[model samples]
Target: MGAKTALLAFTDGDLRPRLLRPVRTNPAELVRVLHPGYEVTPIEDDDLGENTYPPYDTSYVAVLEGAELFCDRRLVFDPPSRLPARVLEAAAGRRVIMHGMHSVSDWLGFAVWENGDLVRSLSLSPDGGGGDNIGTPYEFELPFWAGERPVKAPYPLPFHPLVLGQAALRAFFGFVNEGRPSPDDINPFEVALHGFRVADPTGREQAEREAALQEFLRKVGPPRQYKV
Candidate 1:
């Protein structure tokens, strides 16, 4: 299977206008912010290479009791909710991106917050295993979680809800770019393929990679549409 990727983002209240970018953080910093005392082995460049194995190559992992979370590999975790919750806290109310590639998970999901309030969240695994659609965004979900009412979200055209994995990235980054303080938003992110593109395709590999970049940038739909 290809690498398992996920788009985890935290944003300002109202769920729009801007994404909350917390201070710069890393694996060690994540430990302090999310789970202290938990052993964390930082993910180095080699860990992200194609040769890396499944789950391991996908998300950054750390050992936990009865649960070992590959930090970046948010989607593959059994419950899935566990990873995002920690991610939100780690954001501490800033917009951030967790692992964003590989693109595999039993159930793909998304969650957005408005003024620290969870507007809505939904997770669906292919097993027809079901997921949590609780109204509140507080609790990170695991199975056996049945909530009162299921909140709903508007789906973008041409994309099925089940296949929103790539779409999520475009939306968050699109929001991030449109709301950028200045030219910085237009700048490519340090990680992720957001800024990486082939100026001239010498072969099939580079050409295909460039095509993916074009599609990846469509999260905002049209740049002109976002202008006030």
Candidate 2:
């Protein structure tokens, strides 16, 4: 079993035109390709005013503890901020996984929690074989913060879900079996999902994605072992 819930973060809407859309090859044709459905607005003054850490795009996908989707672009939270009371309460005494795509470096990272305490964090990097090199997933005895309060650290890598899957699973399972946190609190389904998300390819094109991931892991070998 693995983490049942996960949080996914993506690029902000305001910078899409310049980052995702505008063809450096042809700037004048930008507006013509724009579609009403594709429009993404900048963060509002009120929202920006309250934000403490550097601004991040609000787009994210949060898979809740009970296997529900909470997709929104306004779920952004700054570093050092505590998980929402509701989110924390729901995750109380349970394992939760938070995953997000880093647009700046096109990397992905995940935090593993048990009984509301973080146990491990990991990120991957490009190994230059048209694949990724899995970095050592850091195991923590207690929840570690990014800057202030204990939080998971994000890593940089190429933005491919398959590549993210391997790193995420290794972290999740490694923490569950060996980290200081106890899995007795969180649901087993959550743990299973951690493995499933890494191995399953139903939603993604099965053959190609799985093949790429397998090839990558085969090259990288097992994650470096640490003596707890």
Candidate 3:
């Protein structure tokens, strides 16, 4: 079974704590309003087929290995583990929505944001038992941090439930648990969220989206222009 998750990033530039609202648009309505298309998976394995959701036309890429999708909005995912790279990259430098379903081999998480600020980031993976990450602000590292992302042990591993300093814990996860760490504070490279369960729908399509958005912006300067 595949892991189903949708991470949405917005460009509104607010990072506050707010729950992701559910998708109000109906699937049948989506099919009627937009044309459907196909997108290939980012996995190295060629055996996997294409992803048929999002109608393939509403996808957007924020950066390399990062997907910034607004089409998903607040759609609910069942056991979400796989998310396109474009969506993950979108989470940084903007307001975003990330949700993951439980899976043994994949990272499962639920993180909510208010505007562009973080609120709660919880890891639902059972891999490390109860010691696994339950709450964190995992969304902060999505921006293009300047450094070589390590792929081995000892070095920082992305989304590995970083070691929170006793003093800093109150600000991060909102609570400090004993037996964790009390000395030095450190971070983990959550680049793996960008690497794993990712897909590449199309670079050309994303470019087109950016162009379309630009054109729309040019026509209407901002939301105030459309106010009645």
What value does the lDDT take at residue 191 in candidate 3? Answer: 14
lDDT of 2: 0.32
How far in Å is the alpha carbon of 200 misplaced in model 2?
Answer: 36
| RMSD of each candidate relative to the true structure | 14.9, 18.7, 19.3
lDDT of 2 at 64: 24
**Tens digit of lDDT per residue, candidate 3, span 90-119?**
344454455433233444444455443555
Per-residue lDDT over 20-104 for candidate 1, one digit per residue giving the tens place of the 0 to 100 score: 2223323355444444333344344322123112332233332222212223332333333445465555556643333233334
- Best lDDT among the predictions, by candidate number: 1
Residue-pair clashes per prediction, in order, are: 15, 13, 27
Our model 1 lands, by Cα RMSD against the true structure, at 14.9
Report the CA-based lDDT of candidate 1 relative to the real structure.
0.38
In terms of lDDT, the poorest run of 10 residues in model 2 is 191-200
Tell me the tens digit of each residue's lDDT in model 2 across 1-228.
Answer: 122212422222211121112121321122112211233333222211121112222221222222322222222222213335455454335454444333333444454455655554444334321222223345431122122322144433224433344334334322221123444222222321110011222433457656898998999999997896
lDDT of 3 at 180: 50
TM-score of 2: 0.28
* Residue 54 displacement in candidate 3 (angstroms): 10
